[model samples]
Target: MRRVSAISWSLSVFLLSFFFHLLPLSIWSEPAEPTPAEWPPKFNALLFENSSGKLHVIDFWYDWSRGGSLRITQNQLAKLTYERSWDNGTSYLYPSEIHSPCWLMHIPPGILRPNWMEGAIYHGQQYVDGFLCNVWEKVGVVWYYEDAVTKTPVHWSWIPFPGEQSVHVITFNVGAVLEDVDKWEVPDYCFNNNNKLENDEEMKASAF
Candidate 1:
C-alpha cells in the first residue's frame, strides 16, 4: 500500500509540472512591447509625430501654438525643447499622456493670437538631415504618418510650411489626430511673417 501511494504522488507531481509548462507564458510574465503596427491606437500613439531637429528623447504635440516662425531648410530644422506640464495620461480632449517638449504658453495678455490660444500645443526641431532613419539623398525623404481628423481647421497659419517663415508645430494627447490644416474645419493659427524662430535654446524650449 505504501509503495502504491508513493508512485501515485510522484505521478501527480509530474502532471502538475507538465501543466505548468503548458500554460501561456503571459500567465507568469508581463506582455511584450507592441510592434509598430500595434503601437499607435493602442498606446493612443500619434501618427507623424515630429519635433521640429535633433532631440534625443521622444515627444508628442498636444495643442495648437502660434507666434514666431522656424526655418526648415531641406530636412534640417532648429533644435527644440519645452516645459513638461502633462506627461502621458488619459483624457477626452486629450486622450493620453501628452509630451509637450517646448513652450507651455500661459495666458499672457499681449502676444496671444487666434492660433496662439490657451492650451494649444506646439513644438519645433532643427534637423540636419531630417528626422527620419533614412540616409541623406534618400528618395521620398519625408515619410508621412497616419492622422485621424477631429474638427481641426483646414488652414492654420501657425504650422511649418515650405516658405521663408516656417512656424514650428507638434501635437499630443488629443482624442483625434489631424492631417494638414486644409483637411479640417477649425480656426487658423496665425503667424508672423517676419520674426521667424531662432535655432537656439531660449527660443526652442520652455518651462511650465
Candidate 2:
C-alpha cells in the first residue's frame, strides 16, 4: 500500500511552500525582516507530485481575501481522496489530512532568487499549457516553466529521495479566474461520517 498518511501530506505542503518562498531569502545577500503586511499576492494552483512510480494529484486553491484555502489530494494507486480547507472555522473532509494553512508564505518580487541559480541550466523560452515560460533545470529540482511576463514559477518539481526518489511538481495559476467562494465549502456528503473512506483496499475500492 502506497498510502501517505495525512500528516505526511500536510508536512509536504508546508515543506514545499517553504522551499518556494525561501528562494527570495536566498537571493538577497542581506534581507530585511519580512512583515505580515507585505505578504505576497493570493492565487490558486494545481500541484502534481510523482513519487517513484506512485502519483498524487492535488487541487490547491488559496485566496488572501479571507485567508481562505482549499486542498484536494488524490492518491492514484490507492484510490484515496481527502480534502483540507480553511474557510469557515478550518475543517477537513477526512481525518487523514489536517487543516494547516499558516505554514505557506508568499514572498514579494516573485522571481527566481538569482543566487540559487548557480549551475542552473537555462533552456531558454518555451510554451507550457499555452503559457510562454523560461525553463531552468538543476538536480533534485526542475523549473518546468516560469511565466514569461510575471517571472513567477508556473511549473516546477522537487526530487527529494528519502528511500526512493520522489518528484513533487507544482503548477501555479491554474484557473484563469479565482474560484467561486462556495467551492471552498465542505460538501454536504461529507457532513456525515458514513461517507468517509479509509485508506484500505476495501474502502478504496468502494469509495469511488
Candidate 3:
C-alpha cells in the first residue's frame, strides 16, 4: 500500500531492495522523484471489434506530427488519422465526413482526472499481453492497466455508468520501435475541411 511513480517503478524498487538488502528505506528519503509515465514512443496494433467483428491496424507515436501525438487507423475502407496537441487543439482526416473518436488515441489519465489522488485506488496486479500490470481505478469509473516493465498503459476501459459498451483497447507490440514518419502520414484524399475537429478540450470532455 505505497505510492509509486508507475507500475514499472514499483517492480524495480522492490527488486532493487533484494540486491541492496542492507540499505535502509529511510536512506531513500531524498531520492529523486520519478518522471510520470507516458505513452510508448511507438506502437502498432490491430483492434478487433467484438460487435461487428471487424479489425483495423492502428499506429501511434508521440510528437510524430505537427507538435502533437498521432494515431492512424487503417482498414478496408480507408485510413483515418487523428492528431491532438496539449497546447493547441485536435484535428482529423478521413475520406468522408466522419469525425474521429477520441479513443483512437491514448490520453494521459493525469489530464482527465487532475484530482485523481483523492479517490484513486490501487486494484492490485493483473496481466495484460503477458506483461505484469498495475491496475488502478479512478473515481470508481475509469480503469487503467499499466505494464510493470514499461510503465505505459497497455489497456484502458471506461464504463459511463452501470451498464454500457465499455470502451476498451487491446495493445500489441507494446513498445516496439516504429518509424514516426511512416506511421504519421495522412493520405492526400483526407484533407477535406468537413472532417476538421472542434476545440480539443470541449471535444475530449464530451468524448470521455
- Judged by lDDT, which candidate is best? 2
Residue 151 shift from truth in candidate 3, angstroms: 3.2
lDDT-best of 1 and 3: 3
RMSD list, candidates in order: 17.8, 22.7, 14.2
The runs of at least 3 residues in candidate 1 whose Cα sits more than 4 Å from the true structure, single-residue gaps closed, are: 30-193, 199-208
Higher-scoring candidate on lDDT, 2 or 3: 2
Candidate with best TM-score: 3
Whole-model Cα lDDT per candidate?
A: 0.29, 0.52, 0.49
Please give, for residues 10-116, the per-residue lDDT of candidate 1 as tens digits.
99999999999999999899654221111122111222223343222223333323221111122224333222221222111111124322222232243223223
RMSD of 1: 17.8
Against the true structure, what is each candidate's TM-score?
A: 0.24, 0.38, 0.46
**Model 3 stretches astray by more than 4 angstroms:** 1-36, 40-55, 64-66, 75-87, 96-120, 150-152, 160-192, 195-208
Screening candidate 2 with a backbone cut-off below 3 angstroms (N, C-alpha, C), the clashing residue pairs are none
Q: What tens digits encode model 3's per-residue C-alpha lDDT throughout 112-137?
A: 22223334577777886677887777
Candidate 1 shows a clash count of 31
Q: Model 2: how far is 153 from its true place, Å?
A: 1.6
lDDT of 2 by residue, 1-208 (tens): 2366777888999999998887866575664322111213455566776656667787766555545556666778554444544434444444233331112112233323323445567677878767787776676454545667776655655555443433333655633344465656654445443333334353334442
Clashing residue pair totals per candidate (backbone < 3 A)? 31, 0, 0
